[model samples]
Target: MRVLVTGHRGYIGSIVTPLLRAAGHDVVGLDSGLFALCLLGPAPENPPEFDVDLRDVTEAHLQGIDAVIHLAALSNDPLGSLAPQITHDINHHASVRLAHLAKNAGVRRFLYASTCSVYGSAGADLVREDAPLRPLTPYAESKVRVEDDVAAIADSGFSPVFLRNATAFGFSPCLRADIVLNNLVGRAVLTGKVRVLSDGTPWRPLVHVQDIAAAFTYALTAPTDKIHCAAYNVGTEANNMTVEQIAGAAADAVPGSTVLVTGDTGPDPRSYRVDFSAIRSAFDGYDPQWSVADGAAELYENYTRWGLTEYLFSERFTRLNHLEKLLAAGVLDASLRFQLIGAGCE
Candidate 1:
């Protein structure tokens, strides 16, 4: 399998690309290099890459690609809220356009990296892939729109599998410190305190980044009949936990660290516990190996080994902060397209 992975320099993509290649697939990466300077540690040597944005992709880019794993987007809620229209333009419109081009260019497998945030505030019920999507932010809404548009174009000739991934947390070369678990662990490792922002009551399903890479690998080679035009919630049911639970896990991972629940009590409506039985039943070899404890321990070890500092906690590893810095520095315009001066548009 010759795979084309978009956003190959991102936090998850950085891990997934190597995993795909280790699985014996010939991989080519496509990234606009927005976060090229935001690397946390050493960068992985990637395969042949195209310095192209998803919106600019044509059928020529997908000419010899057997599978397309779409991961490029305005990743989080804060980044999406920074410019909502640009989020829609890049995450929704560009993604659907890329899918259309891939299908037309004879790509058989299209693995969309969807999010579990689409099931917003599913109160005590266990949300599944068939549940109604109640997106709460521009980021989650964009994912829903892309999933629908791409699934509508699915056919026997083109198999599109939607992996509705849970909140990803783990170590990657392109590490991120903004997500809940990572933020908590990073804060603990840096300041000896784990801080919870939203009262630590919201529920979130979490998955390790390596497990996510494995899920994509499974989807790329699974039987077309089993995965064609289907969506799977990617995570184990046991990993669905509350923010306080995750904070405790982080605290336990770091020695002499304390958990601080700043009782803000603000209303966060993005709480959901996902049921991942569908994916377990759909794919035979699919099993998430990392627990929250395992992820927290891994982050602790890596942060210690890499010498945790204030710099790592700053814009260098945080996505929204890095993008804002780039915008302020005139490297990226308001629309997130790179300025014509440095490295030309990529």
Candidate 2:
């Protein structure tokens, strides 16, 4: 399989690109380099790459690509809320355009990295792939819109699979401290306290970053009859945990760290538990190995090794912070496009 992975330098993409290569697939990368400066550790050596944004991708870029694993977008709620229209442009409109281009260029498979966040606030119920979607934020709303549009275009020639991944947490070369487990562990190690901001009661399904990479690898060659236009929630039922439970896990991962519920009683309305049975049934060897405890421990060990400090907690490890800094510094324009200078932009 010759694969083209978008956002190949991102939190999950950095891990997924190497996984595809290790599995004997020829892989190429496409990224706009928005978060290229937001590095926590040494960057991974990527394959041949097209330094381009998702919105700028053309059918010419899809030539000879057997499949595309689309992971490019404004990835989180805060970033999406920062500019909702931009999020819709990139995450929804651009994504649908890419799928059409890929299909027109004879790309057989299109794997989309959707999110479990689409099942926002489905109180206490284990939501399945077919459950009514109620996206609370622009990020989740964009994902739902993309899933609908992409699925509508699926046909005998083009197979589109939607992997609605759980809240990803673990180590990557492009490490992110914005997500729940990573943020908790970073705070625990740096300040000896794990803080929960929202009264610690919102339910979230969490998955390790490596597990997400593995799931994408499986989808690359999954039976088209099984995965075509199918949406699969990608995490186990056992991993569905509340914010309080996650905080305890983070506290336990760091020695002598205490859990603090910081009076943020505004209970985040975006809480839901997901059912991942569809993925297990669809993929022959789908198995997610990392638990919340495992992810927290990994973050703690890596933070310690890297000598984490309060200063490192700025835009360097957080996506929203980094983008805001770029926009403020004029590196990225108001529309989130890079301003070309001296030599042409990469």
Candidate 3:
């Protein structure tokens, strides 16, 4: 299999790209490489790579790609809200546009990295793949729209598979601290402070970057009929846990770490739990294989050995906390967050 991965250098793509290669498939990574550090590793030297923004996607970009794995976007809910127009244009509109072009160009399989966040406030819904979608954020809305577009385009012969991924964690060279598990662990390791933004009650499902990579690796080889126009919520259902539970897990993962639940934290209305049985039934024996506790420990060990704590304490270099970095990715500008941050930095 020959696969073209967009946003190939971002958190999930970084992990998925390597797994695809190990699966004995030829991989061609296409990315803006903006959200991550300069992508390194071996390629065919001349293997396909691109820096085009999603909105500007052209036929030249789609030439000869067999399977398309679209992981490029604003990459988060808060960032999507940072610039709704750009989010809608790139994440929503351009994605559908790119898939359309790929379909026309004879791409056989299309894999999309959707999010479990789409089942916002799912409450006790158990979030099945067939559950009614109630997207609450621009990020979730873009995913919902793109999933719809992928399904529609499938009638035209594009076998689209949507992976509504669990909230991701774990270490990657493109380290992101915005995520719950990583942010908590990074803050604990670097500043000795684990700040809880929400009331420690909002349920966020956890998955490692490698597990997400595993899901994509499975999609790449799975029969087209099994995945075609189908969406699967990836990750363990039992992992749907509270912020505090995750915080404790991270704190326990690192030595001498302090977990702080700020009283100033307010309720996060977008809280919800999920069920992953549908995917297990579909892909039989689909195990997440990594728990939050295990992932936190892994992150802690890696950070300690790699000097990741130095960046966290510096403030300016923290991958997940710093918004200037996000802007540098063409998602936001430095002025936006600090300007917005002053209004309580929420």
State which candidate has the highest lDDT: 2
Each prediction's Cα lDDT score?
Answer: 0.89, 0.90, 0.76
lDDT of 3 by residue, 1-346 (tens): 8888888777777788877887887787776545444211222222456755566778777778888989998778877877787788878888899888888888888889999989888775566787778889998999999988778868646788899999999887666767788878888887777778768888888788888988888787777666668888889976888988999998898888788888575977677777777677667456789998899999888778767745443343343345545455545454332222222111
- Report the error of model 1 at residue 33, Å: 0.4
Candidates by lDDT, descending order: 2, 1, 3
The C-alpha stretches of model 3 lying farther than 4 A from their native spots are 38-47, 310-346
Better of 1 and 3 by lDDT: 1
Q: In model 2, which runs have C-alpha deviations exceeding 4 angstroms? A: 340-346
Worst 10-residue lDDT window, candidate 3: 337-346
lDDT of 1 at 41: 63
lDDT of 3 at 156: 41
For 1-346, candidate 1 gives per-residue lDDT tens digits of: 9999999988889999999888899999999988754665677888899988777988999999999999999899988998999999999999999999999999999999999999988975799888999998999999999999999999889999999999999999888888988999999988899988777888999999999999999888888887789999999988999999999999999999999988786757789999999998888989999999999999999988887688767768777888887788888887888885443212
What lDDT is obtained when candidate 2 is compared to the true structure?
0.90
